[model samples]
Target: MSITSANQLELLQTAEAVAREKMIDPSLVIEAMEESLARAAKSRYGAEMDIRVDIDRKTGRATFTRVRTVVEDEELENYQAEFTVEQAKQYMSDPKVGDTFVEEVPPVEMGRIAAQSAKQVILQKVREAERDKQFEEYKDKVGTIINVLVKREEYGNVIVDLNPGEGVLRRNEKIGRESYRNGDRIRCYIKDVRREQRGPQIFLSRTAPEFMAELFKMEVPEIYDGIIEIKAVARDPGSRAKIAVISYDNSIDPVGACVGMRGSRVQAVVNELQGEKIDIIPWNEDQPTFLVNALQPAEVSKVVLDEEAGKIEVVVPEEQLSLAIGRRGQNVRLASQLTNLDIDIMTEEEESARRQAEFEQRTKLFMDTLDLDEFFAQLLVSEGFTNLEEVAYVEVSELLVIDGVDESTATELQMRARDYLEAQAAKALESARALGAEDSLIEFDGLSPQMVEALAKDGVKTLEDFATCADWELAGGWTTVDGERVKDDGVLEPFDLSLQEAQDMIMTARVLLGWVDPADLEPDAEELGDEEAASEEAEA
Candidate 1:
């Protein structure tokens, strides 16, 4: 064989080698070469001209040729149209006016340009095939952990060499506070598998949210078996993490299951995370309850939620404030992210102060005119009824039910209770009016001026009325406009009143005549009892 033929054989062998290395078919390489030659010929000649190339697969020898029609006169010089009828008949017996002929052009020397062009086509085809294969291989592997060998680092990012190709482990994907030496064996999740011009490019992350999820799945059998589910997780990698978990089986405690026996399951995950503290909180449908749980190890007393703003105010006991807020505010910070809430932490003292301020405004309403002392003054001191208005609305029955009162005394207390409440009702109306409450009188459902005068004439003028007034005064001593004795049925029944007949009549009259501010008339008996005791002591 000549030197030229040897070089041709070497070229064929090189193409085959490249195809095998790239996992592409050898025929694809030949196709790529044919395409490259066709393009080169077209660029040199024109699209109107027909071009063809033939290659001996075994010998790696190639020949290029052009085909054209044989015309009577050479209208176009480059036509290669020479052929007598006799000679044309040699190839085709039925030669006619439009007879075509194949003219073999001498093989052009494969110059540097042609060789470069062929190399590019072969490389491009191989890359495309490899990319297609890689995409199919990795697309399904997302959300899974894959072990990749560290190949090199570029621009401060680790490049992982996989079985077939290379992937990227960007700096951000690297776990914070973790150091990686060259050739270090590290496990990471395939965050994403994307295709690029070069080949299949995988994105790996050691700090992804799913990383913890996957770790938990591996460590906790409950998670793997579907008994428990990790709803969401937030982490400050290498430091702390918060994960919300829920159990499908109500019989199983989700948090405890996730925690494993003696925390063995969770401890394994924590070890993998380099001792990162994990708070596995039970997931709750109620936002407030979920948030409170999210701030683990910190006891929460109350949660005020502003769902629209994604904000929550958590009140904790003064001693637990630091614990709830966590060291350097990490507890609340993680809670916020886990529950998707903007959290504000408050101590018990702050909450107390807030309650006090609210009480002051509510009490200022009827403290002056109504002699709240008869019912609430002693009770307030005894039971801590800081707010007077809260006391005015107490139910007489509940007050009578307290430890010290007897049934008979409670009965007497009940009769005068409505009068005491009516006075407070009038005061609340005046307060509402002062505060610019529109149609304040309309707000007071049934109380009228005539009702108030009749109640007063019956010695029911103040909140003290029911507690101080004689039974006859409350029953029938007062008269109606027609001069008929006012029936006991017309008076408001004490909550302790057992007779349904009498209670209904009084309640109906109050509702019809508008004798009380609906707001004030509904007293919290607990508060009223407390205030009443306070009032008695003050008087003593």
Candidate 2:
């Protein structure tokens, strides 16, 4: 193939056709042609010479040129592509070292091998441009639901046509046991879009919880209009799912609206999910109240929530236990996901037994530590005084309210409790000092003697060591590892230290050691206060 004057316009026509077929910019195809021509020119001319090609966008004319750069005699390397500045006087009045000399050169004829090589180069560039265009077209479609035509199946994965590109629905991302044939229309969630060496990969999913939520948004006009909001969703693929919703308008019931008239709306979603049963629950600000609603179709006798641990205990009647837990604990599992809390379900009888065991344990502790008889200890426990600290530090008037307890008896009880606690503290202090604890830590006002002992055992024996500790290290926290929350035990966690309290104590220690400036924290505190005030106002 040669760039003949008669067929020069054919180049522009070919570039336009290729660009239209690939749905890419025509200029990209022309650029690829220019590069291919340049490569052929280099092969025809001396390999060391710098050959270039320019294609006119409108006229389709190809111009070829040979360029030689002027350089110092000592720096010149390629004799064909570079010339000495002194030798460049023939081409220019005053040539600089960086100047280039250009002369018109005839275009090279593409032989059989060269034509094949140029074809590959154009194909490579066109493919790259096509991939880039596909990536840009689909990247913003992530998290959206789209209808696609199923192209074919590779192994267990289904490839779908996105009109301009193809998406793969991985086996794991499909609804349980779902299968499709070629040309089947399927609705899927655009989970991800990535650009790879081969091409742009669009990952589609039918099992995502977001798919369910989006379906409802499409079906329910209130949700689409922001009158009702889906707070959370959890799905078991083709089995069962749960969704929590809230209504901003008081007149609109979120659950009722989602259920639709006579179950039409929810039934549509359920049918799309292959009959996946869905439980629509109302959203609540109170976690325990919300959890009680989440565990539907079962009567809950009580709900005990541990906020710090993100756990809850639900007590139900014995007959309702099976219903609350559902088949293979599915109900409780879905409820846990919906509420974002670990749930422990038990019969009412189990709760009673557990309460009895705790009451007896508290009674025994009072009897052993306070020199009280069994009856007196039980009475104290019944009066809600569980520990020595409560008994020792409680107001005298509170003790006087107890049966058969006057001022004198109250005084005696407090004295005994205080004595025992002081002895325990002194023993802990002695042990901490034995473990190389310093007076600097012992004198820290926020830490208890038992806390000092615990710190000493953990090799944190000085105030400086405590100041260097992270808040989570002293207050404990939950960490997400491999999609599961694991507990990170803290040195001071056993003493009921909260994260905020630990942070404040550590900052105080740092200030005392002159390791931190108080003024540096003032701006942060003010900003936090302002943010909190704004949040409260918005809530109101």
lDDT of each: 0.68, 0.92
User: Which consecutive 10 residues in model 1 have the weakest lDDT in total?
Assistant: 492-501
| Tens-digit per-residue lDDT, 239-297, candidate 1 | 99999999999899988877888999899989878889888899999999888789888
Clashing pairs counted in every model: 30, 0
lDDT of 2 by residue, 1-540 (tens): 677644888989999999999999999999999998889889899789899999999899999999999999999999999999888998887999899999989878888988888889999999899899999988998999999999999999999998887999999999986889899898999999988888999999999999999999999999999999999998889999999999999999999999999999999999899899999999999998899899998889999998887878999999999999999989998998899888899998999999899899999998888888989888898989878899999999999888888999899999999999999999999999999999999999988899999999999999999999999999998887864667899999999999899999999999999999999877787799999999999999
Relative to the unseen true structure, what is the C-alpha lDDT of residue 275 in candidate 1, on a scale of 0 to 100? 89
- After superposition, which runs of candidate 2 have C-alpha atoms over 4 Å from their true positions? 68-90, 93-101, 509-519, 524-536
